[model samples]
Target: MDEQIITGATAAEITASVRTLHERGALRPGDALPPVRELAALLGVNRNTAVAAYRLLAQAGVVVARGRAGTVIAGHEAVAQEGYAPDSVLRDIGTGNPDPRLIPDPTTALARATGRPVLYGEPVIDPALEDRALAWVRDDLPGRDLRITVTSGAVDAVERLLAQALLRDDAVALEDPCFLASIHTVRLGGYRAVPVPVDSEGMTVDGLRAALDDGVRAIICTPRAQNPTGATLSPRRAADLRALLAEHPYVLVIEDDHFSMLSQRPYETLIGPEHRRFALVRSVSKFLGPDMCLAIAATDPETAERLALRLSPGTTWVSHLLQRLVLAQLTDGTVLHAIAAAGRHYAERNAAFAAHLTERGLPTEAEDGLNLWVALPVAAKTVAERLVLRGWLARTGDEFVLSERSAPSHHLRLTVHDLTDEETARLIDDLAESTR
Candidate 1:
């Protein structure tokens, strides 16, 4: 065992020792440091002095007390030093991520817009943006009687809608292997999560019916470009889901159209006219830019009223500047042209990856959005681990699971945009070898 000989006669000495350990790469994110008692005994210092030092680190976001898990290094600082800049990695085949290179350059436009100071107590949603947004939303939701409200993002809209509609411990149905953000939000809000099964055609109607039978009060569905799987609800599937939902008219149904404009697949709205309470959330992050942090929540009057209550004047309204910036890009012909180019690029690149996988005798399906969901012959986790060993990071299907079930899936979500022909071929070869 290494000797921890910090002769700290004072609190300052203890603090300095802790800082030195962090600076010298002794501690890292998710690494639990020695307990205060152990440190105190090892360093020949008073327990209070060690405690104070730990507290100081915690206050400075250097460490976090995870209750039973003990104190661990807090954020990205340690990871950054370890060369774990998540965004800089090659071929990040993870979540429903959009290519940052495609987002229109906002520097010049934002600088010009910022010249005028935004006044306090002004309307949260820019009128010009609202008009355009309404038109955009109305396009797919044609002739549907709905109202629109803007939120920071789709997740925010989900949280607020749930808060307004459901109480703690009330059950909400979600897609099994659901989006991580939805899982986190539902669990954090003290709600019971009911899992609805998903297959290639999207959320299964039978599974949703079972969740409803379990007394769920709400359901969050993804109709197109379902994250992690890149699955869309086929027309037949959508009709079946609508039929299943018609029975539970009072239950709040939230369809997160997260892939909205970026989706290369034809738009299918799951909110059937007969369903009395529902909301359709479409986010601009995947198409415009994640930093834009804008989403339009269109809902029936009752849910809209409750959502509006949460967004009242000062509470949860998105910034007008962001709204204006998004509006500018949405209306600009040049920006629209860029978005069209991005769509084509994504479809072509993903198709190339699918072909590469097929050539290597690996099963793969190329779909809309910026990523590909390839089905491996072995377990997805095993494949992901093998990729990690080869210096490539990927997300496994298990991370998306929301229910208790056996039978492992062989699917791996991969972002293929940045990969060249050589890189794609290499990835396919490695994947085939890993499976074998």
Candidate 2:
């Protein structure tokens, strides 16, 4: 609070002084830095020098400019999925992955890979793969001049989309109880994640609008089979979101349909034709397997062009071999049927598990995806500890939150569809007893 504390003649010195303040615990997260003009006068520097110092701090993620609210210390730390504890003798059900047995074998498709080795300066996307992927997304994509760009996975596509357009400290609206990867990606990029609460009908309109008022320049949403919470955007909800987003057409909307082939619900898009900037991404991990590491990003040609800079040939394009394999599996009728069957399997099993819990008077619901989002009667971590004693591993929902500082909620995202009859009964019994 002392004027003599901030001693600096140039931008570098001013930035260093702020960092020292934070390091010494004098300035904590959410604490506002001095105004540009005030700091300039105090440090005997011009206003431009103070502004440049703030910009440096913003880009480095030391502070965030909150429009008229001035700048505040950057406060987000990305949350990582607490993978199952190693060496624990428990039936692990915490991993939010697909049942491996359902994933189609790529061996038959691999032999179909017959082509010349792609060289530098050649086109980045495999032609057949691009064509097929485009057809897959065309039905739901809004723009007439939509373009497709393939990336290693959905996370890669989202990362590239944001990095190409946004600056550090720019606000991004994210679903609360969001996907782990999306949370990690946005926060690690130094963007503030404005939490939008998601209900059974998907992201709440009020939540989205509140975030927009906070000056969020970007939005990341899951239209169907949302992770951590098995919420899907209904037709009415999608229409409301599209209408609200139309007012801010320039806000970049990136929809991650990561459960495309395995989602029980039909593809309902949020991007309106009139909306200028938006993207739709579908990754093959759920259906084919996570190891495939491939996804298709459909966006306006301008965004596609900008995203291409990082995917240019000879630097970071997806491999032609992987493209061929994905294309082969997609076009084959047999594989298509297999994919459908897998979708049904996940839906039926998840529904059954949710039904069992509900029957036991422990509320649970799973509209789609590979997991069930249950409303626990007790703190999920405490229930998780009880499960551990019963030789079961559970994933608590608080780990998926945007702010870990908030009060822990009574929810657990469980991936127990793989359990057998007795295992399910025993786990349900244990869960019921633990709640009592």
Candidate 3:
């Protein structure tokens, strides 16, 4: 609270001073920061200098602007993450993972993946993998003259693409009910997230218009198997979005087709033929197993060059062995058949579960992707609590929503495809009773 404690002449210096203060316990969470004008006067600096300092602190999440209340220190908030609880005994049905049984065995492919050692100056992409990947993604892409770059996974690709193109505090359009990793990525990068609501047909046009109007520098889209909601972008909806995006041709568009291999729905691209500045990322995690962390990024020439800057030879390039393995499995007839069967298995299980809910007077639909989005008669939180008592752990739809106005979601995203018939029946009965 001492005016004497705050001392700095420049924005970066002021930010560092505040950080040191916080580290020393002088500026605790919820403590109000000095007003910009007052701080400028005290520190004998220009008003813009103080404003820039505050902006830096806000972007780092050390302080939050509270309108009339002014700015206050922000304590760490709980971030939603993927996978299961570390020590929970509850049967987790909300993990949102692919069924392990369906993932093809990698033993044979691993053995064949090894070859002569790649030197530091060799091309980053394996020649065979690059060739196969190009053919694989070419048909679905609307844009031409695309270049490919590989990354660890979809999350890594997105982070690099955004970092290359955006500055801290730049606005980015993200789906309201979004993928957990995507949400975390934007927040950690200090980017302002503009919420774009998603419907059964994928990201709504109105929501996107609002984000664009807000001046978002970049937009992240999921073309199919949109997480948490299992919504696929219809051809008509994709056309509509392309028309809207056509005007803003320079805004960086990053489309993550994370479930491309397993999606039952047709790929509908938002990128128009003439539109520039875009990247399409496809990860092998869903079908090839999550441990094999490799993804292919196809982008415009300029974007590709920007992204390449982050990847240094031998230091940051994706593992050549892993890339070869993925390509081999992808081209194998047996692996292809297994992937197809796995897709059907997920679809059938979700449909069966939806049918059960319909029979119980709670209508639900089996959409594409590994999970089923079910609407509950009561609050999803209440149902989840009841399910917890009945030995089930469920993910509430609220966790995926980006807007506070969309809180207290009544829907629950359930991944019951891997459950046995007995377990499925038990979950259905428990869900019905919980809703009541």
lDDT of 1 by residue, 311-413 (tens): 7666567877787778778877888888888888888888888987888888678866677778888898899888877667777777677766587767777
Instruction: Report how far residue 302 has shifted in candidate 3, in Å.
Output: 0.8
Candidate 1 backbone overlaps, count: 2
lDDT agreement with native, every candidate: 0.77, 0.87, 0.91
Q: TM-score per candidate, in order? A: 0.77, 0.90, 0.94
Sliding window of 10 residues with minimal summed lDDT for model 3: 399-408
Q: Which digits, one per residue and each the tens of the lDDT, describe model 2 over residues 149-261? A: 99999999999999998988788999988899988898789887899999999999999999999999999999999988989999999999989998999999999999998
| lDDT, candidate 3, 113-194, per-residue tens | 8888888978889989988888987887744988899999999999999999998778999987999999999888878788
Cα displacement (Å) at residue 290, model 2 = 0.8
Clashing residue pairs in candidate 3 (N, C-alpha, C atoms within 3 angstroms): none
Judged by lDDT relative to the true structure, which candidate is superior, 2 or 3? Answer: 3
Worst 10 residues of 2 by lDDT: 76-85
- The parts of candidate 2 lying over 4 Å away from their true place are 1-6, 10-12, 16-52, 63-78, 82-85, 403-406
Q: What is the lDDT of residue 332 in candidate 1?
A: 76
Query: What ranking of all candidate models by TM-score puts the best one first?
Result: 3, 2, 1
Candidate 1 has an lDDT of 0.77
